[model samples]
Target: MIFVLGMINAFAANPAPPSPVGRTRPPPPPPGLPIDENILTMMLVALLFGIYIIYNFKIKQKTPM
Candidate 1:
Protein backbone atom coordinates (compact mmCIF):
# COMPACT_ATOMS: atom_id res chain seq x y z
CA MET A 1 0.00 0.00 0.00
CA ILE A 2 2.74 2.41 0.98
CA PHE A 3 4.78 1.65 -2.09
CA VAL A 4 1.86 2.50 -4.25
CA LEU A 5 1.11 5.65 -2.34
CA GLY A 6 4.77 6.67 -2.48
CA MET A 7 4.95 6.18 -6.21
CA ILE A 8 1.83 8.28 -6.59
CA ASN A 9 3.29 11.05 -4.48
CA ALA A 10 6.55 10.94 -6.42
CA PHE A 11 4.67 11.41 -9.65
CA ALA A 12 2.55 14.17 -8.13
CA ALA A 13 5.55 16.34 -7.18
CA ASN A 14 6.82 16.56 -10.74
CA PRO A 15 8.55 19.88 -11.38
CA ALA A 16 7.96 22.21 -14.24
CA PRO A 17 9.60 21.43 -17.60
CA PRO A 18 12.81 23.15 -18.70
CA SER A 19 12.42 26.77 -19.84
CA PRO A 20 13.85 28.57 -22.84
CA VAL A 21 14.60 31.64 -20.65
CA GLY A 22 17.10 29.58 -18.66
CA ARG A 23 19.10 26.32 -18.93
CA THR A 24 17.77 23.49 -21.05
CA ARG A 25 17.45 21.26 -18.02
CA PRO A 26 15.67 21.93 -14.76
CA PRO A 27 18.07 22.51 -11.87
CA PRO A 28 18.61 19.57 -9.57
CA PRO A 29 16.33 19.47 -6.52
CA PRO A 30 17.61 20.70 -3.19
CA PRO A 31 19.59 18.27 -1.04
CA GLY A 32 18.37 16.39 2.07
CA LEU A 33 15.57 13.86 2.75
CA PRO A 34 13.34 13.40 -0.31
CA ILE A 35 10.08 13.19 1.61
CA ASP A 36 8.48 15.34 4.25
CA GLU A 37 8.63 14.36 7.94
CA ASN A 38 4.85 14.37 8.30
CA ILE A 39 4.47 11.92 5.43
CA LEU A 40 6.94 9.48 6.99
CA THR A 41 5.31 9.87 10.40
CA MET A 42 1.91 9.08 8.91
CA MET A 43 3.23 5.99 7.11
CA LEU A 44 4.84 4.79 10.32
CA VAL A 45 1.61 5.24 12.24
CA ALA A 46 -0.29 3.26 9.64
CA LEU A 47 2.22 0.37 9.68
CA LEU A 48 2.24 0.28 13.50
CA PHE A 49 -1.54 0.35 13.59
CA GLY A 50 -1.70 -2.62 11.25
CA ILE A 51 0.64 -4.54 13.52
CA TYR A 52 -1.43 -3.61 16.54
CA ILE A 53 -4.62 -4.87 14.89
CA ILE A 54 -3.04 -8.17 13.89
CA TYR A 55 -1.63 -8.64 17.37
CA ASN A 56 -5.05 -8.19 18.88
CA PHE A 57 -6.54 -10.69 16.53
CA LYS A 58 -3.91 -13.29 17.42
CA ILE A 59 -4.22 -12.67 21.15
CA LYS A 60 -7.99 -13.06 21.00
CA GLN A 61 -7.65 -16.53 19.55
CA LYS A 62 -5.52 -17.64 22.51
CA THR A 63 -7.79 -16.22 25.20
CA PRO A 64 -10.93 -17.71 26.82
CA MET A 65 -14.31 -16.07 26.27
Candidate 2:
Protein backbone atom coordinates (compact mmCIF):
# COMPACT_ATOMS: atom_id res chain seq x y z
CA MET A 1 0.00 0.00 0.00
CA ILE A 2 2.67 2.49 1.02
CA PHE A 3 4.94 1.39 -1.82
CA VAL A 4 2.18 1.98 -4.40
CA LEU A 5 1.40 5.38 -2.98
CA GLY A 6 5.10 6.29 -2.98
CA MET A 7 5.43 5.19 -6.57
CA ILE A 8 2.37 7.21 -7.57
CA ASN A 9 3.69 10.32 -5.83
CA ALA A 10 7.11 9.86 -7.41
CA PHE A 11 5.59 9.61 -10.87
CA ALA A 12 3.24 12.54 -10.29
CA ALA A 13 5.91 14.84 -8.88
CA ASN A 14 7.25 17.64 -11.06
CA PRO A 15 10.32 16.49 -12.96
CA ALA A 16 11.70 19.93 -13.79
CA PRO A 17 12.15 23.21 -11.97
CA PRO A 18 9.45 25.85 -12.38
CA SER A 19 10.28 28.97 -14.37
CA PRO A 20 7.86 31.89 -14.82
CA VAL A 21 9.37 33.19 -18.08
CA GLY A 22 10.21 29.73 -19.48
CA ARG A 23 13.35 31.05 -21.15
CA THR A 24 15.82 28.48 -22.53
CA ARG A 25 19.28 28.49 -21.00
CA PRO A 26 22.36 29.12 -23.12
CA PRO A 27 24.69 26.32 -24.10
CA PRO A 28 27.79 25.69 -22.06
CA PRO A 29 31.30 26.73 -23.13
CA PRO A 30 33.32 24.25 -25.14
CA PRO A 31 36.32 22.46 -23.73
CA GLY A 32 39.84 23.80 -24.33
CA LEU A 33 40.64 20.86 -26.66
CA PRO A 34 39.69 20.63 -30.35
CA ILE A 35 36.09 21.21 -31.41
CA ASP A 36 35.68 17.64 -32.78
CA GLU A 37 33.82 14.83 -31.03
CA ASN A 38 36.43 12.25 -32.08
CA ILE A 39 39.19 14.28 -30.45
CA LEU A 40 37.06 14.71 -27.30
CA THR A 41 36.36 10.98 -27.07
CA MET A 42 40.04 10.17 -27.59
CA MET A 43 41.08 12.63 -24.88
CA LEU A 44 38.52 11.16 -22.46
CA VAL A 45 39.69 7.63 -23.23
CA ALA A 46 43.30 8.59 -22.58
CA LEU A 47 42.32 10.30 -19.34
CA LEU A 48 40.40 7.24 -18.12
CA PHE A 49 43.38 5.02 -19.00
CA GLY A 50 45.70 7.26 -16.99
CA ILE A 51 43.29 7.28 -14.03
CA TYR A 52 42.97 3.48 -14.12
CA ILE A 53 46.74 3.13 -14.10
CA ILE A 54 47.08 5.41 -11.08
CA TYR A 55 44.23 3.68 -9.21
CA ASN A 56 45.62 0.21 -9.90
CA PHE A 57 49.05 1.26 -8.63
CA LYS A 58 47.75 3.06 -5.54
CA ILE A 59 44.77 0.94 -4.41
CA LYS A 60 44.32 -2.37 -6.20
CA GLN A 61 46.82 -4.94 -7.59
CA LYS A 62 49.54 -5.17 -4.93
CA THR A 63 51.95 -6.70 -7.46
CA PRO A 64 52.46 -5.56 -11.06
CA MET A 65 50.55 -7.73 -13.48
Candidate 3:
Protein backbone atom coordinates (compact mmCIF):
# COMPACT_ATOMS: atom_id res chain seq x y z
CA MET A 1 0.00 0.00 0.00
CA ILE A 2 1.00 3.61 -0.40
CA PHE A 3 1.03 4.03 3.38
CA VAL A 4 3.54 1.17 3.80
CA LEU A 5 5.78 2.64 1.06
CA GLY A 6 5.57 6.11 2.64
CA MET A 7 6.60 4.70 5.98
CA ILE A 8 9.54 2.88 4.40
CA ASN A 9 10.58 6.05 2.59
CA ALA A 10 10.46 8.07 5.80
CA PHE A 11 12.53 5.48 7.69
CA ALA A 12 15.07 5.34 4.85
CA ALA A 13 15.41 9.12 4.70
CA ASN A 14 17.78 9.18 7.66
CA PRO A 15 20.16 6.40 6.66
CA ALA A 16 22.94 7.32 9.04
CA PRO A 17 22.32 8.53 12.61
CA PRO A 18 24.92 11.00 13.88
CA SER A 19 27.33 9.43 16.32
CA PRO A 20 28.43 11.40 19.40
CA VAL A 21 32.04 11.20 18.20
CA GLY A 22 31.09 12.98 14.96
CA ARG A 23 30.56 16.34 16.66
CA THR A 24 32.28 18.30 19.45
CA ARG A 25 30.43 18.91 22.70
CA PRO A 26 29.89 22.43 23.98
CA PRO A 27 32.38 23.75 26.54
CA PRO A 28 31.25 23.55 30.18
CA PRO A 29 30.15 26.73 31.91
CA PRO A 30 32.40 28.28 34.56
CA PRO A 31 31.61 27.43 38.19
CA GLY A 32 29.90 30.52 39.71
CA LEU A 33 26.86 32.71 39.37
CA PRO A 34 25.52 32.39 35.80
CA ILE A 35 24.62 36.10 35.92
CA ASP A 36 26.94 39.04 35.21
CA GLU A 37 28.22 41.36 37.94
CA ASN A 38 26.07 44.26 36.65
CA ILE A 39 22.89 42.16 37.09
CA LEU A 40 24.02 41.01 40.55
CA THR A 41 24.72 44.60 41.57
CA MET A 42 21.29 45.71 40.35
CA MET A 43 19.61 42.89 42.31
CA LEU A 44 21.48 43.83 45.50
CA VAL A 45 20.53 47.51 45.00
CA ALA A 46 16.86 46.57 44.57
CA LEU A 47 16.95 44.47 47.76
CA LEU A 48 18.47 47.33 49.73
CA PHE A 49 15.88 49.75 48.32
CA GLY A 50 13.05 47.39 49.30
CA ILE A 51 14.41 47.05 52.84
CA TYR A 52 14.72 50.81 53.14
CA ILE A 53 11.09 51.30 52.04
CA ILE A 54 9.88 48.69 54.54
CA TYR A 55 11.83 50.32 57.38
CA ASN A 56 10.37 53.73 56.56
CA PHE A 57 6.81 52.31 56.49
CA LYS A 58 7.35 50.59 59.89
CA ILE A 59 8.65 53.83 61.44
CA LYS A 60 5.64 55.79 60.14
CA GLN A 61 3.19 53.15 61.41
CA LYS A 62 4.72 53.24 64.92
CA THR A 63 4.23 57.09 65.10
CA PRO A 64 0.45 56.51 65.61
CA MET A 65 -2.44 57.80 63.45
Best-performing candidate as measured by TM-score:
3
How do the residues 4-47 of candidate 3 rate in per-residue lDDT, one tens digit apiece? 99999998896685676757886578888655759978999999
Clashing pairs in 2: none
TM-score of each candidate? 0.38, 0.34, 0.39
Query: How do the residues 1-65 of candidate 2 rate in per-residue lDDT, one tens digit apiece?
Result: 99999999999998896565866885569888866749878999999999999988888657667
Provide the lowest-lDDT 10-residue window in model 3. Answer: 14-23
Candidate lDDT (C-alpha), each: 0.87, 0.84, 0.84
Which parts of model 2 have CA positions greater than 4 angstroms off? 1-37, 60-65
Ranked by TM-score, the better of candidates 1 and 2 is 1
**Weakest ten-residue segment in model 1 by summed lDDT:** 17-26
- What tens-digit string does per-residue lDDT give for candidate 1 at 7-39? 999999979976669577777789877567589
The RMSD (Cα, Å) of candidate 1 is: 11.8
TM-score rank order: 3, 1, 2
Q: Native-vs-model 2 lDDT?
A: 0.84
Each model's Cα RMSD: 11.8, 8.7, 11.3
